[model samples]
Target: MTITIDTTRCIGCGMCAYAAPQVFRVVGKYSTVISQPEGRRDPKVSNAENGCPVNAISVTR
Candidate 1:
């Protein structure tokens, strides 16, 4: 799986970090990926992508 965040579209709401602490964190004024999931899929990652209010996160397999 691959995860990417469009920084231009991100609002720095920290929802992604809130949804997946192990995979994401709030840095400065943006949410950034801390680590990728070892598995092909992660529910927390999906939740983070979906929870992003500005739709800045993208996940692909």
Candidate 2:
């Protein structure tokens, strides 16, 4: 699976970054993709997606 952020929906909240610093982060006013976290699958990314207040993050296979 892959983790992607809908920049339009991102509010620079940085919740995902705070939840999983190694996998997600905010760059300026938008959510940015850091590196895919190790030893995990779609579920791991989905957790990050769920943490975004704006629902900006998406996990897809």
Candidate 3:
């Protein structure tokens, strides 16, 4: 699985980092995916994606 953050849609809220520090981080004014998930079904990654207020996070197989 792969996790990606759409910087254009991100508001730099830091929720992803807070929810999944191992997989995300706040860089500059955007949230970025910093690590790959253990798999497509990783709960941490999924929580981060769901936590994004702008829906900027994407998870793909």
The top-ranked prediction according to lDDT is 1
Residue-level lDDT tens digits of model 3 in 4-58: 8887899999998998898888989998878786744878788888888899999
Global lDDT of each model?
Answer: 0.90, 0.77, 0.86
- Candidate 3 clashing pairs, residues 3+ apart or interchain: none
Give the better candidate number (1 or 2) by lDDT: 1
lDDT of 1 by residue, 1-61 (tens): 9899999998889888988999998898888898988877999899999889989999999
The CA lDDT at 39 in model 2 is 53
Report residue 49 deviation for candidate 2 (angstroms): 1.1
Instruction: Report the CA-based lDDT of candidate 1 relative to the real structure.
Output: 0.90
Global lDDT of model 2? 0.77
Expressed as tens digits, the lDDT of each residue in 1-61 for candidate 2 is 5778888888998778777777787788987988865555745466678777888887765
Question: What TM-scores do the predictions have?
Answer: 0.94, 0.79, 0.90
Who wins the TM-score comparison? Answer: 1
Which candidate do you rate higher for lDDT, 2 or 3?
3
Q: Which of candidates 1 and 3 is the stronger one according to TM-score?
A: 1
